[model samples]
Target: VLDPNSFTGQEFMMWTVAVYGDGWLNFWKELKPAIKTVAPGWSEGWVKFTTNEAPLMVGYATSDLYFDEKSSDKSFIPSEGGYIYIEGASIVAKKEIKDGAKLFIDYILEEKFQRLMAEKNYMLPVTDIKLGDEYNRVPTSTKLVKVKTKDLEKIEEYKKELIKLLKK
Candidate 1:
C-alpha cells in the first residue's frame, strides 16, 4: 500500500468518498483480508501483476501497454471518472546547462514529442493530438473527480485509519 501522504495515495484516499462515502474505515477492513502481499516497491508490484502472481494493483490505465498490447489485462475509468495525476518537470539547480534544459523542455512540449509519449510511453499527452488506434483504445472518462476542501482536512486521519486497518 502506498503512504497516504504520497500524491497518488492522497488522491486515492480522497476517492474513497466517491466509492464508499463515510464507510471508508469499513471498506479498508474488508479489503485488508484480500491483500495477499504488500510490496512497497512499485516495480515489484508491477512484476507480480504482469507475471500473474497478483490479480490487481492500483495503477494508471495507460500502463497496459507496458505488459502487452493485446493482453486481456485492461484498465477502466471509474464511472465517477478518475482522478488525474499531473506530472511536472524541472531542471536540477546545481547542474547548470540552463539553456539546454530549457531547449529540452521546449522540445518535450512539442506535438511531435507528445505523440511519442502517447504511442510509445502509453501516457495521455498533455497536448491535443490524434492518438493511434491502439492508444485510442485505452479507456478514458469524461468526468473527473475533484477532491473537496473537507477531504483535504482529513488526510492525516485517512493515513492513520488506513494504517490501522492494514495493520489489524
Candidate 2:
C-alpha cells in the first residue's frame, strides 16, 4: 500500500526512466501493476478513464528525466532503452510543387531553418541546431544517449512490414 505518510503534503513525485519504442506498451502494463501493488486503494476508475472528476496527471510523453526531478520523491528506475517511432513523410499527388523540392529539403537541413522549425513546429530537429533552453519543450541533457540513425532506419523498415501485414 502507498505510504500516505510519505506523501502527506507532497504535490508530486518524479522517477528516472528511459523509453524504448518496443517497450512503450509494456511500460503501461508494468506501471499499472506497480501502482496497484504500492497503492491498493487507488481505484481502477481513477487510473483508467479521464473525465471531469478524475484528477488529471499529465504524464510527459517525452523521455525519462523529464519528470523525475519534479516528483515528491526520487524513486525511479534508470531505463537503458531509447524510444523509437517510425515516422514517414510523403508528398500528396493533389499538392502541386510549382518550385523545386530540392530547395525545400536544403532549407530544412540548414541550422537556422531547423531552429525555426523547432520553435514554430515543435517537432524535434533532426540536426544539431541547438534550440536553446527557451524552446526545449523536453528537458533533455547531453547525458541522454541518443538512439543511432541506423537503429531508427531499421525500426522504420520493421514498421513498414507490420503495416503491410495489417493491410493483408
Error of 1 at 94 (Å): 18
Model 1 lDDT-worst window of ten: 1-10
Clashing pairs in model 1? Answer: none
lDDT of 2: 0.39
lDDT of 1 by residue, 1-168 (tens): 444555555567678755677886777777777877654555666777777777886677677667566678787887878888779787777755778898998999999999988877777888878887776656778888876787668778888878666666
TM-score of 1: 0.76
- Each model's TM-score? 0.76, 0.34
lDDT scores of the candidates, listed in order: 0.73, 0.39
Query: What C-alpha lDDT does candidate 1 achieve relative to the native structure?
Result: 0.73
Best TM-score goes to which candidate? 1
Off by over 4 Å in 2: 1-78, 86-99, 135-137, 141-168
Q: For candidate 2, which ten residues in a row score worst on lDDT?
A: 8-17
